[model samples]
Target chain A: MPQREGSPWRGLNVVFFRELFDHLTSVRMLVLEFLVVLFGAAVVYFAAEQIRNTTAEDPFLFLRLFAPPGQSLLSFVVVISILVPIMSIGLGFDAVNGEYNRRTMSRILSQPIYRDALLFGKFLAGLTTLTICLVTLWLLVIGFGLLRLGIPPGAEEIGRLLIFLLVTIAYAGVWLALSLLLSVVFRSTATAALVALGLWLFLSLLWPALAQMLGGVISPPDIRFAQLGLPTPDTLAWQQGLSRLSPGTLYGEAVVAMLNPDAQSMTTLLAQFQGRIGSPLPLDESIVQAWPQIVSLIAGTILLYVVGYVAFQRQEVRA
Target chain B: MTDNVIEASALTKRYGRATAVDGISFTVGRGEIFGLLGPNGAGKTTTILMMLGLTDVTAGTVRVLGHDPVREPLQVKRVVGYLPDTVGFYDYMTAEDNLRYTAALIGIPLADRDKRITSALERVGLQDVGHKHVGAFSRGMRQRLGLAEILMKDVSVAILDEPTSGLDPHATSELLEMIRSLKRDGVAVLLSSHLLERVQSVCDRVALFHSGRIALLGTVPELAREVLGGGYNVEVEADGEGLALRFSEIGGVKAVDQSGPARYRLLADRDVRPQAAAAVVNAGGALRRLSVEEPSLDAIYNHYFETHGGQNAAA
Candidate 1:
């Protein structure tokens, strides 16, 4: 690398604050916030109602608000996994290209700052916005749980919930980075948005099924496991591994581990039945179990951001 | 340290196979208004970008205030202000807010920001509309706002690309006057434009760009002399006995032609208006009109291109 002259972060705070203000006041953000809060409240309310009737003496009742046992299709966690990507994409799909369309890129770049400051500031601003939104939603869900269940969460439950919130932000970071990368790659805002939404749809809705099919082809089930009508361990591992490539899959698995402490590894459900039927695992153990997924979410975010930064640096500032 | 604020030597930019700026060289001194005159795609904007360190230089070196733009971009940018061809601001942002954002980026202290922004806006005659959203601003207003940004930065050099391109004639003259004021403030200005007549009035020196090369470089009169073969054309309209003969006998009058019944076009090495008027009145003739046509940039440009067989001379 050629030795650069000044600090790469010279004007970072300026760009960050300006972009944060824009995101906070934008009508698009208000609409997305309304939708997420509406869906989140409804899902958590239904989950809390169901938990109140079904589980009378469960130790982790507050956790059930996020991943209610009966509703596998639309739990609070599931709603978040699906909508967070959309919200992130909304914040980021036009981040860089909007400047180009407005003809402000050259003027801004001519300031005494590097391109690093601009891209980093935009990413930080988007992530901060996502954090604020998710934290608000988390608190709302907890408050609703307290009203409906009449039980304050244990310190451990709150800890796990906090971890879950961080994991959710990391997941949001993944999609935000991907959309920002698309913005840098495409000059037109419409094209960048379309491609980002298309990618979100593919990863969230179609990639899980595609991964299973591809895994079965790659690692065929053993004859002995097939004769006993049991899924082959190697084949199951391959499918899980392939599916984890999608940020949605990683987020879902991490939330499962965080919210439902009774849940163990994907291939070790028998271990759960052995001696831990009535007891939940400790928060640390749950985190250890979900460590790889958390890392993957965070790594995917950094990888995407690095790619966008490189593309932005190479781009011409003419227009 | 030096009087020159911008200096580029053998500056070149090549996009893959074709050269955009082909080994061009120039220098802009303090308080000087330099014009980069060219047609579209003549590489004027590209050259400006190279100088601001907004684009990479394929070959050659550019220094702004004795700092290399490519290697020391921030140092150069700190002292240089650039107004792009189509300058833009956030449409939803009020003019004051937009200036505030730029002020933060330029690292102006908070204590000084409002005062500087107000004064800069006042300088551009935009103080009254500072609270209005920029989306409602006219093209002339936006161009003025761009200049206000340069003024707020208090930069040593201001590089403007087509500052008055889309403005009406009234706005164009207003912008040109502001450019002249920038010169008066000891700020070097490098402005690029395809309009010759408007730019010629304000530019102290100009480099005519053609196909990525400086086809002509000098003051307007110097260019006119090199290309037009003569300095001044004195038109005298008088009626008397042998009036044309009397005017032709004046010193420095090269040739005289009877253009009309009472008009005589005198080709002169210098302005001969006083002598011609004196001769007409001295000979007891009624001098209808006596005017000197200083060599116009349009004529020099057209004549040079016509003689040189330049096919791309659209401007």
Candidate 2:
């Protein structure tokens, strides 16, 4: 669709292309890109190794790379969940504050473009750059699988692979929006960057533990059920549900569901599936199951981005 | 189009308990050079920000290009070019790249942007250094680049906030000359500066700001007359007291005092030169020197500031 003339979108293309150029050439993104591919490839190697050790007839060998391994090495999902935030935060922590530091904010805002175009253009540019990075990483792992494990992914696995990439992009959007918001709130670029990384650590690593503790405190295991030798399934369910509030958990659930067709739910449920057949759900069913997680990731992105937008619009351009 | 490119009436801005600009009103006409001359914190910057709609007005109305900047900022900004005090540019970018980014932001079409940028650089005398990174630029050079940005926009009104705040005498004069050229191009200029002499020299008229109020406003000579009230300071030096006595006999001399040996300080209601000089030479005294000192912007500014109970802000 054509954008209306003199609309706020008039400058979006100009801003987006310029920011994209900077993001592509900047050393900060380059270093983060190297770390992600390096760490990501290492996990892919271990997964390929695990698959090779297993039966040659294993149909889901390529998909196992995205799941947690039986061994102690970090899985592809965990590595992606950790790395996406760092990459995203690096891209956006300096987005607004760096403009202020460089003294470009006043000059740019004085132009004919509306504030809407400037902020929206920045976000879209960051998301596009992230998409490019993730696509390349996904291709690298799949290529490795093809060359080392000597297995090509089937159509169902390919569908799951596509969904995983989308989920990863959405997760990156959430962190990118957060970093942009921090950039607008804090004056110093370094301060914003530090706060964003600290928040990431709290969310990914610390929140799960805190949520588990808080959930247990909030809903202590029923003593009668414990005395009957039955697990306090409700308390555990609530704790896991609270843990799922984290983007890391959402991403973990999403990628695991996409990468493993045999896996039905994110939680363990051997007791509930005792009489079930060995047949796995189709790719569509898995995606339908992951719809809530996908929506949450996107919703989180929108919520953060809206806040950043309003703050940026109200900010005084003077140094 | 109205003669006033920028019009503000009862413009007010307050920050909680403190009023930054209080009931200020001014108009900037096309092809006119109007100056907001004031010392620091006299509400000049705040007024400029409110005019540009960078800050909201607490009360009252302001229009740039007949559009309320707060309601139609893009429309106002399109025709208005602002060079803020000590404006910064992208340090990593070359001068051309910095301009290119501005062109993109201003929505200058690609086909004509290069030509406009080239001319702007040429006009600002930064053509030779267009490819050098702005980080390496001297402060004066960066200021000229700021002018180039203003030129590239082809804006109708150029608002410059303290454009020569930190420039050397050489750079300051050069920038003033370039600003005069902006007038020749029929662009309205609203420049704020604390330098009364520079403002008086360049501006067609000026408003003297004192403690959030316009203490005086008019052409330089008019303001001088307003504050000095038709009185001119005169000095006459001769070898004899005859010159002092003859100077006192002049028609317009209001008062005479023998301030030094054979030197008479006289206050006159009119140009005392022809009458005082004639009197001195005709008196058979050696008229060593005679000077009729017109009131300067400095004295006028000081008079207004003093009357308004502000600290003595000498130019």
- Which TM-score values does chain B get in all models? 0.94, 0.88
Candidate DockQ scores, in order: 0.80, 0.49
Angstrom error at residue B72, model 1: 1.3
**Clash counts for the predictions, in order:** 0, 0
lDDT of 2 by residue, A1-319 (tens): 1232357786899999999999999898899999998998888887778777874676676778777446434788888888899999999999999888877787788788887888899999999999999999989888888999776888888888889999999999999999999999999999999999999888888999998888888899899989998758888888888998889988878876777767656534651565443556678867877888999999999999999999987787767
- Once fitted onto the true fold, the runs of candidate 1 whose alpha carbons sit more than 4 angstroms away are A269-279, B240-255, B310-315
Least lDDT summed over 10 consecutive residues: which range in candidate 1 chain B? B306-315
True contacts kept of each: 0.83, 0.61
Docking class of 2: acceptable
Worst 10 residues of 2 chain A by lDDT: A267-276
Report lDDT (Cα) of residue B285, candidate 1.
90
TM-score of chain B of 1: 0.94
Q: Estimate each model's TM-score.
A: 0.96, 0.93
Q: Which model scores highest in lDDT?
A: 1
Error of 2 at B25 (Å): 0.6
- Put down candidate 2 lDDT per residue, B1-315, tens digits, no spaces: 878998999988888888878788888888999999988999998888887767777899999989888777788889999898888987878999999998988878899998999999999999999999999998899889999999999999999999998899999999999999999999999999999876577999899887777778888767766776655788888765466667778886778888888888887767788787778667767777888876678888777656855343342
Residue A50, candidate 1: Cα error in Å is: 0.7
